[model samples]
Target: MRSTFDFSPLFRSSVGFDRMLNALEAANRMAPAENWPPYDIVKSGEDDYRIVMAVAGFSEKELTITHEQNMLIVTSEKADEDEKQYLHRGIPSQAFERRFELADYVKVTAAKLVDGLLTIDLKREIPEEMKPHRIEITDETAPRQGNMHQIEAEAAA
Candidate 1:
């Protein structure tokens, strides 16, 4: 049995969240999650993250990683070969594509394949203009002596 949710209320109240809500709804409607080519996301540092995927039987040449705006896509396709015959085939080598949504400023830094595991490193680089900074509050009621002198000099002139 499957359950459905009504987000009409959220849609009416929220603003500028259409993409996020659509992504969530699409995730809910997707087929039951597949276990093939399992992956894990880990937070390595304050602004660093790592996505490790088990890509057994896949080589570096067969895997591709791409970043388009806020979406990170990882795909792997193995070349078909009819020469190898296996009585028992348990490992999944079929073409698969996985997408990950990244937050603002999150960027892919590096990718490496080690021991049949593909590790993708990500770093969040917030621009200086976007970072939070303290704003100095000045007392407007009190006038500085320099300003008073300047005003007096201007009046005399």
Candidate 2:
């Protein structure tokens, strides 16, 4: 049985969460995930992440990685099949495409194929102006004569 959820109430009360809600709906509507090419996502550091995909029969030349506006697209071009008839073929050489959604300020730094494994490294670099910073708080009650509160008190007198 397929399950569906309504997010109308959330939309009525929330702000700035449209993208997240759309992602959830899109994921629910997508087809069954393809498990042919196994992959792993690892969090290596506080702001660093790694994605490793197993592509046994694919070469570096046949694989492509693209970063387009918060989306990572990995595609494997279909190679010509040989005429050799195999009694039992197990390895997969079929063309496949995989996509990954990246958070804001997250970017792919490097990708390398080693020993039939494709590794992609990503890092999140928040802008200096956007990062959280310490804000100094001062005593409001005990203020200088030029302070707004003091001015207001004198004006009322």
**Backbone collision tally, model 2:** 0
Model 1, stretches more than 4 Å misplaced?
Answer: 11-19, 138-140, 144-157
TM-score of each: 0.81, 0.84
Where does candidate 2 stray beyond 4 Å?
135-157
Q: How well is each residue in 17-66 modelled by candidate 2, as lDDT tens digits?
A: 98888888898899888996899999999999999999998889999999
lDDT of 1 by residue, 107-151 (tens): 999999999999999999999999999998888898866677543
Clashes of each: 0, 0
